[model samples]
Target: MTINRRKFLGATVAASAALSAPMALAAGSGKPRVVVIGGGAGGATAARYIAKDSKGEIDVTLIEPTRTYYTCFFSNLYLGGFKEMDELGHSYGGLAAAGVNVIHDWAIGVDRDSKQVTLAGGAKLTYDKLVLSPGIDFVDNAVAGWDVTAQNAMPHAYKGGSQTELLKAQLAAMPEGGVFAMVAPPNPYRCPPGPYERVSMVAHYLKANNPTAKIIVADPKPKFSKMALFQEGWANNYGGMIDWVGEEFGGGNVEVDPNGMTLSIDGEVVSVDVCNVIPAMKAGKIAEIAGVTQGNWAPVNAADMSSKADADVYVLGDASQQGDMPKSGFSANSQAKVCANAIRGALTGSRVFPAKFSNTCWSLIDTDNGVKVGATYEATDEKIAKVDGFISSTGESSEVRKATYLESEGWYSGITADMFG
Candidate 1:
């Protein structure tokens, strides 16, 4: 919970010295300090792996505003009442144990020419190498009449935290037969199948608590990840309780009246008791300020995750533009390993091995049923290309679904261990 300033500063100094010592020795004697921005999946994984693998040779400092992280992967279960908030939250104690310098602060901007990151608290950190994984920032203008303040009434819940809690509360307090509308974002968003999976979980909760309640999905894309499986599951599990409007049906277009909880599409204004509008997203503000992001996402070399705009900097997670990789936490964690290895090699002047990465994203349809999509990728000519993968098959047996559910939980534990523990 609360980090003691003396203890935290002591740990940070120790961690930094540990990381920089090896690089310093390799360079005929000065440690190389690495400052990693963000402490979610990518940043935490990179910091932990670098500190552990380098054996205190590379000084690693991690900057994060929050003391804990709530994973978006399984957040749907929280809405379904299958998991508690604490179950989805993870702390950074493991990183500290691994000798990572965890700085609880927000990065305001980066001085690329000087290799320094400016913190919101007016601290400037110099780094031999910088890794940024600040995650996504929602594009408020993507949806009309929806801003930060307006979102209080129609919660997006896309990024977790208070928004997620607010959405859950609204769902719980809805009238017995109230309508809940979810407007899913367009392509290239975090967790391609997340919105549908969320709808399934909400429907599951409604079927048990408020049987007459209805859930509607206004999808921007006609086809989604695990489309067949989701459609099949929805029909069999909650028939007539869920309605889906694909792109052809004007579900792809969305305009919001946050005050009225209404969505205007195809010249029609439909009112809902509760609305969740997941807008388009881009790299975090830090990335933009650092000149690493091109449009909405940061562009990095696939082989090393080094920013195309700045070689000394690397970007990962939903913030990076890894063409073949989905913006899932699993992908971010995997990319962190690659970034770690690259940083180690860069600091030590060693041969950097070819990078290969893999990701698996699991979505819980309900408490027991789950579906997954996985893939392996490699870098070629500075671009990532998927080599193998499979989306879960439609109508899988209950036993298989149960197995996937267990596997998903195992992955969450394993990933957390890899990143923090």
Candidate 2:
């Protein structure tokens, strides 16, 4: 699963090309408007690109309730104490400085017929094109006997803010040699490598403070992304400290007793000191309110991430049902660029490039030990399809691993800057 240097360099060039500040916008008579909901990787990038690329020809408004965004990606490192809370937090001031109308409010309803969005603040915003990247909401029945109210006890820590701090505190409060159990989510969740990376980081923390602490992962999925590399790292670095049970082993049949802090799998009860129950997820509530979601996620056309249900509306990131792409920030950012290109073209008669997408996922196994998997994609008539892909292999030199980790650090800085400003 190693990436050849030539293939890697070539792909890097093409992906970088898309990130270049867009060309001078074609002059248009009236400014077309784009309203972006949820200022995360997708929404922020779409707003920035449309405004920056359109060069004052497109009025971009962004709706996000939170003034600061804490990224779910790399939050695992924060739990492991490898990163500070401020490192994960980002301010919306940068977006505002970039000429985006940053509104701190919730979007309550969508009237597609009139191309209007109703906000919780009792205001209305009309847009010629709308971008929705509202992230995820948990399914009520995804985990039996566990609901939002029970989340305080067995923290999911999936959203990467206070929940992350809560999980970190729980880890620190665990008595020596105590058990830490997790109920990993099913397929098509944000950051495919995230749960496993969290496990690695937890193991790292426990080894230093609670050497005998045990971790049990009851995962509904039979296998996860980067399984081989993660298993090897576990064996090498934290042998006998972690146990992973897949669906065939009844890991999917789990129920929690929050009062007792018990996790039951296959009718077998296991008392746990700390519990992490990540449930199956669906599109954010706004997507459902907008009537754009089909089943659990919003369906979109591959060409420009436009909603299949409504042409003027586009969905990106974890909320989209686009094919062959994992629910990742990188994927969302890539999709936004494509959507921006199309929107700009429609609004100002600007040049529309072919929709080419790329994503790279990096996971840290230990300090200076990281691994990655990536692919280039194309928008097909039916779905977004993979073009070429590569991954870090099982056996690599320490030099290569360190370099990979450093590469991820560089990417984190660059992508955040791209999204925020």
RMSD of each: 6.1, 3.0
Task: Report the C-alpha displacement of residue 386, candidate 2, in angstroms.
Answer: 0.5
Worst-scoring 10-residue span by lDDT in model 2: 1-10
**Which segments of model 2 are wrong by more than 4 Å?**
1-30
Q: Give one digit per residue, the lDDT tens place, for model 2 in 1-421.
A: 3434445445444644554444454455556789999999999988988877666778999999999999998899897778999999999898888789999999999999999999999999999999999999999879988998998899989897999999999999999899999999998788899999999999999999999999999999999999999999999999999999999999999999999999999899999999999999999999999999999999999999999999999999999999999999889988998998888887777678899898999999988999999998999999999999999999899999989987887777767777887
Model 1 misses residue 81 by how many Å? 1.4
In model 1, the Cα lDDT at residue 319 comes to 95
lDDT of 1 by residue, 59-95 (tens): 8999998888887777888999888989888888889
